[model samples]
Target: MKNSIFNTILVTLSVSLLLLLGGCAKTIVPPTDTSAMATGSDLEYPESHNTGTMGEAGFSEDNLPLEGSLDDNSHSFNDTDIMNMPEAFRREHGRSSEGFLPVYFEFDQFRLSPEMMVVIEQNAAYMQSNPAINLILEGNCDERGTAEYNLALAERRAINVKRYLTNTGIPENHIRTISYGEERPLFLGHDEKAYKYNRRVDFIAE
Candidate 1:
């Protein structure tokens, strides 16, 4: 009876020790990936994010309360419609109604005369000051040559003026060329005085 009692006590002690060791093992082992169980309160990147699918964070011009609306063009400007704009608005946008002085050429010649070069220089100075000015170089010729030949000459006249302006620091794109040839004469008479006035390039501001 004493031996059986001692054996039973030993068996009881072994079972209690095994149970305590199993509990300690569970408490000591840590999770492999802590991020997997994160609640995302202090996480660098959230497990799931809503990227403004229903306007939660996305930005759109249509949805924003902008100071100006697309239909409100009172503050906007169109370069092509500049001529129709009011004088005040035109001045505000760096435009002027002042005309550029015309540059005359010799009869049937597209080359710039020394005097004509002086005129072009002055024009370039004006253009430099008002860099926003758009120019239309209208080339005219005396009623001397055939329509085709005069038209070609007129184009050369306009191109020459354009080249001179561009060389003087004016942007080439700001100047446009149009050839009237001998069709639109400044002086209708068939005299040397009339021909002299007709052979010219007139600058129109837009």
Candidate 2:
């Protein structure tokens, strides 16, 4: 009978030990679902995304200047509009006497001559009167040099004309420049008459 009682007490002690060990055991919480946490508070978004603008990556159309907005003078001519420009202004080689006179340059020179400066001043005056008109400075060159060299020279001529116009209170962005080089000559010949008409910057109004 004593042995039986001792066995019962031993079983009770074993049960108590098991319960104490279970109470002290650490709880395994399935690693806290770190994958969802990684995508939540720690996720980084692009600047455009944060602003809720519609565009891929960081490019947003809201940042672009509005069309016909004169405040910034941000206007651009598409290829179709350029193609529809007057043939006389596009390729005809001649001096304009009245409105938007062509600014002539010396052979292989991009500097604005005193006479050319006067022409630019007149053009600037015209632009000041019509603030909404956009201008295109088309630089040309005689067909005497390599196409590449003439193209670069023509570009310089256009830029110089643009600089002069900007100094005269015209918005810099209102003027667009293009170099025709020897591709579009008013006079199509090897003589000075042809070269004289070809080496000029023509103003096209839009």
Candidate 3:
């Protein structure tokens, strides 16, 4: 009877120990989806995804219109206003030489404006009235651009003016074109006002 009770007690303690060991054993947590964990890194670091140029990847400030550009309304008046006036009035205005007007261009553009066309019309009429008169169209530019670029731009300005004058009946042989680039500035100051004055094509009777 004593042996039977000891064996039963040993068996109950062995069962309890087995249950405690099982309870203490660490629960096996299956490996998580590591792909999902890595998805957040791309959002956290932006430069990692950089392919190359700003234009290729996304928007850039260079693509936007510059603030306070010359195109703003404040600079509405063009050089033609002062240049294309009558000889008597121009002398009073004290801006241009006798019987001719200077033509001006916007920053970085070779295209002639409506005001420029009007000035050219008056110039054409003057040349028509005086058949012996020959004119030299001197192209110029502002101080902002590179020397080579400005030279090319000035050439375009002069050529365009010459073309228009020829189209208006001034003989092509009568007009000569020259580019001074930024070397000859009509206005000496460095502001936009000065730049506006500098970017011009002056007409000198040769």
Candidate 4:
């Protein structure tokens, strides 16, 4: 009778020990979707999915040049000079250069906003009226992301503007596109106020 009682106690103790161990154990579940595991820091522009020309060119930040400026100042008329021209001369050549405003974009976005579309429409109308005037769309980006990535993003921004202009009756050949990336900034600062100005596509006479 004593042995049976001792055996029951021992069995109870063993079961109790197993329960304690099971309570202490943790069950690890592996992530089912690897893409969902990406954190904000993993991507430079977390909101933007398009990598643009970087993928096509097979370029990385390490491979790109550190110091260089892209400029083609071969245009005959500057904004000030064009604006100061006589009314008759402008009518014969083109409208006031002030009409060609810089087109701005949202953070890390290449898609045109409704407001930006209106700006593009005005620029396109001017271009359509003055077929002799060739224009350059200078794509720029804020001081964010890798040089290669920014260049690619900027190129996409300019290409989108050009696409809109062409769709609005502006000849493709009359428009040249260039990407300055973060090399040329309208405002120099890390804040959104400055970044908003830097992220733009300027219209320049070519």
Q: In candidate 1, which residue ranges exceed 4 Å CA deviation?
A: 1-97
Give residue 138's lDDT in candidate 2 (0 to 100). 76
lDDT of the structure predicted as candidate 4: 0.65
RMSD to truth, every model = 33.3, 25.8, 26.2, 15.6
Error of 4 at 41 (Å): 30
Estimate every model's Cα lDDT from 0 to 1.
0.59, 0.62, 0.61, 0.65
Residue ranges of candidate 2 with Cα displaced over 4 Å: 1-98
How far out, in Å, is residue 121 in model 1?
0.8
Q: In model 2, what are the clashing residue pairs, if there are any?
A: 93-186
Summed over model 4, clashes come to 0
TM value for model 1: 0.53
Better of 1 and 2 by lDDT: 2
Worst 10 residues of 1 by lDDT: 51-60
Where is model 4 more than 4 Å wrong at Cα? 1-97
Clashes of each: 0, 1, 0, 0
lDDT score for candidate 1 against the true structure: 0.59
Q: Give the least accurate 10-residue stretch of model 4, judged by summed lDDT.
A: 33-42
Candidate 1 per-residue lDDT over residues 35-152, each given as its tens digit? 2121212122222431111121212112322221113222212445754666444323322235367777665456566676777888889888888887877777788756655665
- Sequence-dependent TM-score of model 2: 0.54
**Alpha carbon lDDT at 186, candidate 2:** 68
Ranking by TM-score: 4, 3, 2, 1
